[model samples]
Target: MFESLGFEPDWFGLLGREVLRERRAALIAEACAWSVGLSDRPHHLRLRGRLVATGSTIGDRAATGQALSGEEDGRLELGDARPGSFQDALNAVDADGAVFADRFDREVIEPFVHETCVLAADRARRTRPGQWAELLDDLGEDGAELGDVVRAGEWEQPLRTDAEHLVLAALGTAPLLEVEAEGLPLSLVRAAEATARAAAAPRPEPEPEDLSGALFLALAAVREAGLPAPVPADDAPRLLAALAEQGLEPDEVAAVLPHLDLAPGTADRVAALLAAA
Candidate 1:
């Protein structure tokens, strides 16, 4: 399965016969090499594959990957899956130095991105106002950017407005979802409201667009939970790059549709939305 996702699982080289507990620590180190791409299966695999192929003489570490995943609630799930919080894995290596730039981004940038999308989705779900307000305060204390945006107020209206147009394309939904906002956890609302205010005000040059990060996250969640994919491991740089590059052309869109697990029309719509963004 790992192989299908563009990861040549050289499990032996990565672990070198280490015991299960030790293997976990080792895996943490390997995954941290480029934590920015840690969420990207293809990138993670590519890094692991590098350690073995480079002629590192070591005993087989055994299969740490196997241990990293297991079934819970009759469904497969990944363990220690905190792409942001490294509470468990932090002790594996000393992080006093500058090797942890991306770690803060997990919280500073990532959560806002997620919260923004959740608000945009406006779906029927649990709503936590007190918790969200507290978290927003916490995020602002943790990062300057999010705070600046939130203080502006009116940060969420555009995203909710844009959701009317882009959400369908983002999630490839038809007939629209009946789910209500149920009170959104303050994510990208601050950013959206701030951008709107900026646009309304006069400036020498058009402010760089502050695109809502919510749409992508929403689409990805729907795709993973509802869409059919070629086993998560089948990911690759080409496919990931296409996703990162916002201006996806028709040809590029066509080329990647097969791998996306999205319908042809849905993929085209997604491509158009991305391109227009």
Candidate 2:
């Protein structure tokens, strides 16, 4: 799996299993129960089953509502039971519920909100159509690979491919402070090298914003592909030159190209540039 994701553990494990599954009902129910005393018995029961399957502490399982309620407060305040922390720290935060929020952080909402972001990141990384179809099948016949998910609309493709997939995966996972942390693909190394060169080139006048944006996008796409992050400063120029020497060209990078600002003639331009090179 690591090799497949370009030896990036962060990118490989970026997708969370639960977020990929149909979890709105459970999450909504958990939130409702805590905030407004709304209880979907079935939803609660399903959550309970998940808790049990995961072998979570009883107190932790019971604490979802309480922890959520304490969203305003950072501290989690358990009535009395002191269960061990959760296996997944995010999940544990949810398990801590209002109790943790009430005591430690005084109802700070960020911790709880971040849990949702993490879940989304995992869901975004999920690309298995078969498994997703099975899940939809469970929802209903209409749910299985619904027409909407099967076709490209305004977007060029029905499903994301290569670099686009990586970008969404990174965004879904959150906290993308650096390219190295994103675990992008090596396919992007060339693009990064190219962009860095473009960005650093000592032009007489400033470069166009589009050029800069394109360069950044190129670099980002490489990382999303699970390749190594480009080295910094002077080191990057050598790396870019090496990639160019290896015959890495624009066309070779189509699969990992960013969707941003892509236009009707964009594909042709990229293809032509790559082919000519």
Candidate 3:
């Protein structure tokens, strides 16, 4: 399936995994930053001081002028009458940390997966009519990217999972290239879905590739979705080079097409799109 769109599943899988890992790392970093900010609070400093005072007894035992060594008490002791406050502070920090982690996991990580999945699915249904379900099924069938995304719950897991989802979504349902085939691009399909969803329109089911006019509509939709209009005169090689500059390949580019399943005419249009770009 991916081959038709110009991508090798294996390479794309690796890329997907990397993207997932990176995303999780970013989320974790953001959480850590929040933790750092909390740690800077005056309340935390006061609490820490109390904890040190209560926990420590070394000062009492150590010679007045002797340097305190780790071998002596194995832990630091604080001055009298402050241990309780310090303990309270430590507890607060711990609790805050837990909450931060939880929020990142649920709020940022989970929602990202759902949004990316929905976007991918919407595009698939538009581009690969009569095949969206099958493509989605196949993505999850062999424990490919789709399954990985669905299994993601943590930072790294979700990011990797999303990568899989993106690849699967991109390649999910490209229409065959044919003289009479539609020329829809994946981007267009996604845009249309977004529009429909916004309007509360009943989501359209995938349709079989029919008139060539669909290609124009799909291309227009993609443009509306933020992609540049199709280029003219660029063949596979030039297009591949251009997309490669954007960290993509011909196959990946093909997967982005909603009407890739069409015949030579549609293929030529794609080539032209690439060339013009």
Report the C-alpha lDDT of model 2 over 213-251, residue by residue, as the tens digit: 445555554454443433333333333343354445544
Error of 3 at 256 (Å): 67
Q: Which 10 consecutive residues of model 1 have the lowest summed lDDT?
A: 174-183
Report the C-alpha lDDT of model 3 over 129-153, residue by residue, as the tens digit.
Answer: 5554554465553324443433432
Better of 1 and 3 by TM-score: 3
Please report, as a residue range, the 10-residue window in candidate 3 with the lowest summed lDDT.
171-180
lDDT of 1 by residue, 1-277 (tens): 8878987653222221222223333222222332322222211111322311212100111111111111121111112422223221121112122112234334333343335534322221124445445545644543234334333433433333332223222221111011111112232454467689999987688674433343454335445444344423233333434454455444544454554454335554555555765
Alpha carbon lDDT of each predicted model: 0.32, 0.34, 0.38
Q: What's the lDDT for residue 162 in model 3? A: 59
> Between candidates 1 and 2, which one is better according to lDDT?
2
lDDT (Cα, 0-100) at 91 in candidate 3 = 26
Two-way TM-score contest, 2 vs 3, winner: 3
lDDT of 2 at 239: 35
Off by over 4 Å in 2: 1-126, 141-277
lDDT of candidate 2 vs native? 0.34
